[model samples]
Target: MLGALLWGVVAASSLTLGALLALGRRWSDRVIGGVLAFGAGALISSVAFELSEEGTRTAGPLPVAIGLAVGALSFYLATRALERIGRRGGGGTAGLPLALGALLDGVPEQAVLGIGIASGEGVSIALLVAIFVSNLPEGIGSASDLLKAGRSRRVVLGLWLAVSVACALATIGGYGAAQVAGPGFSGVVDGFAAGALLVMLVDSMIPEAREKAGEIAGLLTVLGFAVGAGLSVLG
Candidate 1:
C-alpha cells in the first residue's frame, strides 16, 4: 500500500512539474504542440501495449470491450457537460478541456498502476513513463492557457495540486479495491483507462497539437510512439 502511494505520487507529480514549467516561462506554440504530440504518442503506445494488451490477456476480449464502450461513453458525457459549463463561463474555460481530460482519465490510470503493484509484478515502467510524460504537456498546456485567461498563478498551481493529490490517492484506492476484486476487474480497469485516453487524444490533444505544430506534429507523434513502444518491449 505504501509502495502504491509512493509510485502514484511519483507518477502524478508531473502535473505539478508541468504547471511549474509553464509558470516559469512563456512557451511558444510549436514547443507546446510538440510536447502534446509526443505525449499523445506515448499515450497511444500505452493504451496499446500496456493497457489493452494486458487487459485482454488477463480477462478476455469481452470484458475489455464492454469496458471500452462504457469508458468512452462516460468521457463523452462528462466532457460535454464540462464544455457547456465552460461556454457559459467564457474565457475562464481556457485550457479546461485538457484539465477535465486529465481528471477523468487520471483516476483509472493510477488505479491500474495500483492494481499492477498489488499483483506483485512491481511497477510497470512503460505505464509509469507514459503517464508521467503525458501529464507534463497537460500541465504545461493547461496552466499556460489558464494564465492567459487571467487566472492567477496561485489559482492555477492550486488547481493542479488538487488534481495531483486526487490522482495520487487513486493508487491507494485501487490497491484496496484490487485486493477484493477478481482478475476481470483489473482487465476492466485497464480497458477503461484506454478508452478514456483514446477519446481525449482524439477530441483534444491531437487536434490541438496539429493546430499548434502543423506538419511537424505528425512526425513527432511517430517518434514518440517508437520511443514508447521500444520502452515497453525493453522493459
Candidate 2:
C-alpha cells in the first residue's frame, strides 16, 4: 500500500509542478502549444504500449474491447456535459470541466501504477515516465486557460491539488482491488484507461496544441511519441 501510494504521488507530482510553472510565468501560447504537443505524444504512447498491450495480455481481447468502449463513451459524455456548463460562463464552477477532465485522464494512469505493484512486477517504468511527462503539459495548458478565463490562481492550484490527491487514493484502491481480484482483471482496467485517454487527446489535448502551435505541433508530437516509445522499449 505504501509503495502504491508513493508511486502514485511520484507520478502525480508533475501536476503540482506544472501548475506552479503555469502560474509562475506568462508563457507564450506557442510554448504552451509545444508543451501540449509533447504531452499528447507521450499519452498516445502510454495508451498503446503501456495500457493497451498489457490489457490485452491480461484480460483478453473481448474484455479489453468492452472496457475500451465503456471508457471512451463515458469520457465523451462527461466532457460534453462539462463543456456545455463551462460555456454558460456564469461563474457556476467554470473550471470544473478542466479539473474533471484532468482527473478523468489521471485516475486510470495512477490506478495502473497500483495494479502493477500489486501484481508483484513492481512499477512499469515506461508507463510511469509517460504519465508523469504527459501530465506536465496538461497542468500548464489548463492553468493557462483558466487564468485567461479569469479564474483565481488559488482555485486553479487547489483544483489540481484535489485531483492529485484523488489520483493517489485511486492508486491505493487499485492496489487493493488488484490484490483481491487477481491479475486477470488488470487488462480491463488498463484498456479502460487507454480508451479514455485516447478520446481525451482527440477531444481536447491535440486540438489545443495545434490551435496554439500550428503546423509544427505535428512534428513535436511525433518527437514526443518517439521518446516515449523508446523509453517503453528500454524499460
Candidate 3:
C-alpha cells in the first residue's frame, strides 16, 4: 500500500512536470507522442502477457473468452459515455471523456498492486510500476491539451493535480474491493480494464498521434508498445 501510494505521487508528479513543459510551449510533439506510445505499448503488453494469461489461467478459457467479449462491449459503452462527457463541455472537452477510460485502467491496476502486497502476491511491486510507466504520457497529453486551450499553467496544474488525486483515491478503493472479490472476480475486472485500455489506444491516442505528429507518432506508438510489452516481460 505504501509502495502504491508512492507510485501515485510519482505518477502525479510526472504529469505536473509534463504540464510545466507544456506551459512553456517547448514540449515536442514527438516527445509527447513518444510518451503516449510508450504508455500504450506497456499497457498492451501487460494485458497480453500478464493479465491475459493470469485471467485465463485462473478462470479457464471459457470464462476468459466471455470476460474478454464483455470487457470489449463494456468499454464500447464507456467510450460513448466519455464522448458524452466530452460533449458536456463541448469544444476541447471532447477528449476529456477518454480520461475516464484512463482512470478506469489506472486505478484498478494500481489497486491490484496494493492488494497484491497485502495478499503476499509476488512481484506486485513490479506490476504497479508497469502501470505507472504507462501513465506518464497520459499526463503529458492532458497537460498539452489544457495548454492548447489557453488555460493558465496554474489552472492546468490544478486540473491535473485533481485528476491525479482521484487516481490515488480510486486506486485505494479498487485495492480494497479486489481483495474481497478474489481472483476470479478480479480477473473479470482486469479484463474490463484491458478492453478499456485498448479502446483508448485506438480511439484517443492513435488518432491524436496520427493527426498531429504523423509518421513519427506512429513510430513512437510502436516504440511505446514495445516498451510496454518488454517491461511486462521483464518488469
Candidate 4:
C-alpha cells in the first residue's frame, strides 16, 4: 500500500509537470499523440513479453485469460456507463470520455503495485517505476484534452486530485488483497491490468494517433515500445 501511495505521488508529480506545460498554454497534440501511440504499443508488447510470460509460468494462461477478460469487460462497461452519463448532459461530455476512462482504468493498477510490494519490494518498485513511465503520456493526454475543452484550471486540478486520491486508496486495498492471496494473485492482477491496457492501446491510442499524430509520430510509438521492452533485458 505504501508503495502504491508513493506511486500515486509519482503519478501526480508526473502529471504536475505536464499540467504546468498545459497551464503555460503550450501543449502539443501531435507530440502527445505520438507519445501515446508509442506507449500503447509498449504496453501491449509488455503484456506478451512480460506480464503474460510471468503469469502463465506462475499459474496457467486460463486464469490469466479470465482475469484479462474481466478487466477488459470492466473497461467496456465503465465506458458504456460514461457514455450514457455524457449523453445525459454530464457537462463537457463530448471531449472527455477517453480521459475519464483512463482515470478509471489506471487507478487500480497502481494500487496493485502497492499490493505487489507486500511480497517483494524490488519487484514492486520495478513495476511501479515502469508503470509510472507509462503513465506520463496518459497524464499529459488527459490534461491536454481537458484544456482543449477550455476547462478551468480549478476544475481540472480538482478532478485530478479526486481521481488521484481514489487511485491511491484503491491501490492500498489491492495491495492488501494481494498480500493475503499469495503467488497466483500477482499473475491475476497483472493479467487484468495488461488486458485493460491492451484495450486502451487498441481502442483509444491507435485511432487517436492516426487522427492526430500522423505516421511519423506513429513510428515513435513503436520506438517507445522497443525501449519499454528492452528495459526487461536490463532486469
Cα lDDT of all candidates, in order? Answer: 0.89, 0.83, 0.64, 0.65
RMSD (CA, angstroms), candidate 2: 1.8
* Cand. 4 Cα-lDDT: 0.65
lDDT of 4 by residue, 118-203 (tens): 65644444345555566666666667777777788877667656665666666677667876786667667767776777776666
List where candidate 2 sits over 4 angstroms from the true fold: 89-98
Worst 10 residues of 4 by lDDT: 93-102
Tens-digit per-residue lDDT, 67-153, candidate 2 = 788778878889787767756855443334445656876887788889889888899888888888888988898888888878889
**Clashes in model 3: which pairs?**
37-224, 38-224, 41-224, 41-225, 41-228, 42-228
Candidate 4 TM-score, C-alpha based? 0.85
Q: Which lDDT tens digits does candidate 1 get at residues 116-144?
A: 89988889998888889889989998888
What is candidate 3's TM-score against the reference? 0.80
Tens-digit lDDT track of model 3 for 93-189? 5335345556666655555555555556643544666666666667677677766656677877787666677766655565567567766665665
Candidate numbers sorted by TM-score from highest down = 1, 2, 4, 3
Better of 1 and 3 by lDDT: 1
**Candidate 1 weakest ten by summed lDDT:** 89-98
Residue 116 shift from truth in candidate 1, angstroms: 1.2
Poorly placed runs, candidate 4 (over 4 Å): 1-4, 90-95, 124-126
